[model samples]
Target: MDVSVIGSGYVGTTVAACFADLGHRVVNIDIDEEVVATLEAGEPPIHEAGLPELVATHAGPDSTGRLRATTDYEALLDTDVTFLCLPTPQHADGSIDLSIMEAGAEQLGATLAETGDWHTVVVKSTVVPGSTADVITPAIEEVSGRTAGTDFGIGMNPEFLREGTAVEDFQIPDKVVLGADDERALADMHTVFDPLVDAADAPVVETDTRTAEMIKYANNGFLAAKVSLINDIGNICKEFDIDAYEVADAIGLDDRIGAKFLRSGLGWGGSCFPKDTNAIIHAATEAGYEPAMLKAAVAVNDRQPERFLGLLDEHVGVADRRVAVLGLAFKPGTDDVRNSRAIPVIEGLQARGAEVVAYDPVAVENMRSHFPDIEYASSAAAALEGAHAALAVTGWDEFAALDAAFDTMATPVVIDGRRIIERREGLTYEGLTW
Candidate 1:
């Protein structure tokens, strides 16, 4: 199968490589010259586990495969299926910003019309419901002068790849969902994804386009709500003297919940959860319906950063203090800081005029780019050195060893955000919810 993947970010690049690894010819199209150049040089521009190895194994120039990447849209005309991996980021009003996706669709439509190609286009990016037919299909039809299911085919196959574990998720996903209008197009997509299905040992969930689109948003919304629920529980537990970890553990035994995103942390972060949850709520509201519980979930998550700051004030007063923030990324093993709670944590601390020295194993470089005013540290130890207090925002493995590495911090205070650490003896330990 010949596939052209649009957008070369983490999602696009990994999808392109995975398809290439599955013995398909892939042409990855992107607008960034630097990113395209980086991919062509056998180097992954973003940090992800096993990604360099995956790219080297499959999409590497020296590798014996027909995987090539370019910035030209003209190359896409030759591919059998073009995967839209572009981002549909959240707008300022919490609605999804589909301008990028719309522009891409318009360009794709115009190009398809010019080339007169009958290809199957699959939207692999996360999008709000009704977007595929309402926006994308219409644009493509306008460009190609061909109606969907009659002339050109289209489908919505959302991605569920976590940033840190994206390549692994791609290889071992729980399911491959195909949202298509026609059976022929959906079956054709199965051919392109057959390798992933075989590797994942997972079933292909075939459904309508709207169901498939909602699956992505609903999955993210549920995960975000789960995290918020635990954190909300943690907040209430903080008022009364209760161990949130024990409560979370006891609740995990239920087969219905199964304990995955039931983590009590400094709330959910990164690109998908916060935005998707809000978008779903907003979408429902626009349609004259309201999701009150999900709305509360968003509110609770929004309060997390401030709650973390308040916790600092509860144990250790913030006046004339130097606090260490360990772990900048929302999660470990990835450098993405989009919608990270640490932003509010840092802002809250700076508002109090307390000095903040932050460090993340992989995110410090990118963190420095976003926050040039704060002090940057080479390591967690360096961030903790001579600091009045420290907060563990990310649950990196290095943070879990803080009990044994107590000598690293000048002050014996630590705040565990991800609930990874229960009791680091001999230190003034505080859990965000604990």
Candidate 2:
């Protein structure tokens, strides 16, 4: 199959590389000239695990030429299937701002109208329940002057790829959803993913387009709520002077409560959880129903940074002190700092008149955009040395191995948010929730 993916962001780039690797000739379309050039050079614009090597093998001069990128949407006329991978960021009031996705759909519709053959368009970006059938289809139909199911096939196939482990997740996904009302359109989607399903032996979920869209929101919302629930429980355990990990381990033994996303930490933050949960809450409120549990979950997540900061304040006075921050990326293995918990930690430190020095394996450059005046260290050891206190915000593996590094701290105080540090003798260690 000759496939075209629009918008060369994280999801767009990953899917394009993976599709090409799956033995399909794929073309990536993006408006940014620099991003297009980078992809054409067989290099990824984003820092994701295993993406560079995949792009290098499938694209550029040294490889099979199965993958390519372009700045023009007109290239879509030559492809059989197109995936709309545009970003749907949240608005100020929690509703999704669909301006980007709308524009891409209009341009794709015009491109499809120019061609005589039929093409399958899939909404690969996460959206609200009725977005694909209600908003996207109407915008495309108005411009193209063609009916959705008859002239062109439109469907919703949401992506479940995590940031750091996107390649592995896509290759071995537990379930593959193909949402379409028409038989032909659904079959087209199956054809596109047949190779991946066969490789992973994953389950195929057949459903309507609207149901598929809801599945994505429900999936993210449930997981986010679960993390927040655990955080709430962990907070109670902290007050009782009990170890939260031990209790979590005991509960995880039951088959009903599996041990994924069970670690109590600084709460959930990323592009997916915050955006998806807020979008659903906004959508539900518009329909005149208050989502109580989800709202409480968000409340719990928001208060965790303050709780961690308060623990640090109890240990030492942050006013007129130098504090070191460990980890900036939301999680390790990626450089994306969107909705990272480190933002709040740094803000709290600065609010208390503390000098902030931060360090992450790969997220220092990204965090610099948020806090330009703060000092950044090249290594964790450099950030710890000469600091009055250190706060661990991310659970990167390197922080777990810092035994001698804690000895260099002026006050030897460590407040861990993610439980990624080990308690040692001669060090003042405080875990947010043991």
TM per prediction: 0.96, 0.99
Prediction 2 global C-alpha lDDT? 0.93
Candidate 1, residue 69: how far the Cα is off, in Å: 0.8
Task: For residues 200-313, write the lDDT of model 2, one tens digit per residue.
Answer: 999999998899999998999999999999999999999999999999999988889998878998998989999999999999999999999889989999999999999998
Which stretches in model 1 have alpha-carbon errors above 4 Å? 403-405, 408-410
On lDDT, the candidate that comes out on top is 2
C-alpha lDDT values of all predictions: 0.84, 0.93
TM-score of candidate 1 relative to the true fold: 0.96
Candidate 1 local lDDT, 195-263, one digit each (tens): 878877888889888899999988888888888898889889888979887888899999987878777
Model 2 clashes, total count: 1
